[model samples]
Target: MATSPAAPRAASGGPVRLSAAPADVAALIMHEADLLDERALEAWLALFTRDALYWVPADHGDSDPLRRISLFYDDRSIMEDRVWRLGHPKMFSQNPPARQVRVLSAPMVEASGADTMSVRTKFVMFEHRLREQRTFGGVYLHELVRQQQEWMIRRKVVHLVNRDTVLWNIGVPI
Candidate 1:
């Protein structure tokens, strides 16, 4: 996994370089999508760092994740709860599990700071079940950290093009 030459110094007068392999980063995100599509919520949650945040903003570039309303804003505890409910027999939605397929485009590595790197990518997911099919397309913004030769998501922010539109339900991860 060879990296390109060091990026030009930042305007703030600091050297910027990415320590993680691009392919590795790409694979990590791809695997995450696969896990979600496969309904492996527990495995998917494990890929996040302890302090990780998962957010789907209701508005594009909403700035403040907390103050601004979001479709889904979850921490580790919340994610665990979601997984638990998803796995429970009482969870009516799972009586007929949703079928899903996700396609993630090649990741574009952005700014690098210390152990963290920002990534931007596009994705399209098709979810079908009970004779209904819903397609979702959006841009994903991820803050990733290199830990012991593996890249883990520190924060994930999804920006959907039609975020404000009323939807039937977004029960599953997008």
Candidate 2:
């Protein structure tokens, strides 16, 4: 069956313009990846805004952020705690740090609002120990904002392709 095209909706507001360049956005993303790969937790956390949120959703189709539990849902305070724990001598998990390598690719601009942009990117991360290398591949949805001539993360939502597996602790930031 053939269908006729619908008419375009009337403009409720003026067209939006993006002030940041694509190259700059890509550079910021690359820097973030580098920071994680280098295990620079403090520096990595600094890239987030004061009201930033870091989340790893528990299910693929789960959209209610308030009711559903998450793999991780951290604000600045929680993020600070995590950073402190990672470097604290009392943290047994840090005795032998889990080595990790993350590769972020195919970043595409998904949406753009007034002061925020939503980006989706594919990633492959390998967390390795003596003889085991656990690999995770998924897409990351980032809500970023421009602040003081720099782009900082407002929210980072990681969606792992596999949601039903019992996994080891993710001591390090994904």
Best by TM-score: 1
Best by lDDT: 1
Among all windows of 10 consecutive residues in model 2, the one with the lowest summed lDDT is 1-10
lDDT of 1: 0.79
Model 1, span 49-76: residue lDDT tens = 9998888878765767679788989998
Query: Model 2: per-residue lDDT, tens digit, 1-174?
Result: 001111113357643432333787777777888888888999999999999888877877666557887888898899999998988888886567778888987566756766778776678888886566788877777788989877889888877876568767777778
TM-score of 2: 0.84
Q: Would you list the C-alpha lDDT of every candidate in the order shown?
A: 0.79, 0.75
Evaluate residue 166 in candidate 2 and report its C-alpha lDDT on the 0 to 100 scale.
Answer: 75
Give candidate 2 regions above 4 Å deviation.
Answer: 1-21
Clashing pairs in 1: none
RMSD of each: 5.9, 7.3
